[model samples]
Target: MVTDEDKVFKALADASRRQLLDKLRKKNGLTLGELCADHAMSRQAVTKHLVLLEAANLVVTVKQGREKLHYLNPVPINEIYMCWIGQFEQKRLQALHNLKQSLKENDHEQ
Candidate 1:
């Protein structure tokens, strides 16, 4: 019953994983050692989290010479916003625009 988007949401639900994503966002193309430098969790724990993040397509890796550099892939998150949040936001924004137009018309008639 669960979809890939569900997997993305599930991965993002964890604070540790979110922290990893935040770090990548601030500075992309970081190696595993660089990622592990400022974290309370063990390196193995971070590795596990990275696996899940990659499954969700939230993080991508590139082989740069001897190292595998990790980078944040924001496409999944943007898809989530467009598929979920943006639809609801559009309706609310339209209502606000309509209200503003009505108020403008009322002022013009006064």
Candidate 2:
């Protein structure tokens, strides 16, 4: 079944979309025009990417005055980490801790 994590992963598959996320991360709130300012992609292309990002819940928009301000919603990414990467991270930390203890024991024996 396709879940929200699937949507976020799909949206993040494109390099352009990743770049857009990076821009938003650097500056949390920006208008569409501001996001497209230094980018080489067309405004329409950027708009499409933003739409995908919003659909994936990675980006959120708020209408402020006449402008739609876009902001990065990091919750989805955090969820991805907690559900995916975090599992392996705990094992890796435990292994590192064991290695550190072994090294300390070896030093004491010398």
Model 2, 1-110: lDDT tens per residue? 32467799999999999999999999988999999998999999999999999999999999999999999988888887787668768888889989999999999999
In candidate 2, position 2 carries an lDDT of 27
Q: What lDDT does candidate 1 reach at residue 20?
A: 97
Clashes of 2: 0
Report lDDT (Cα) of residue 56, candidate 1.
90
How far out, in Å, is residue 41 in model 1?
0.9
Every model's TM-score: 0.75, 0.76
Q: Which residue ranges in model 2 land beyond 4 Å of their true spot? A: 1-3, 87-110
Per-residue lDDT for 57 in model 1?
A: 89
lDDT of 1 by residue, 1-110 (tens): 22388889899999999999999999999999999997999999999999999999899999999998999999988987787678768889889989999999999999
TM-score of model number 2: 0.76
Report clash pairs, candidate 1: none
User: What's the lDDT of the predicted structure labeled candidate 1?
Assistant: 0.91
Error of 2 at 21 (Å): 0.4
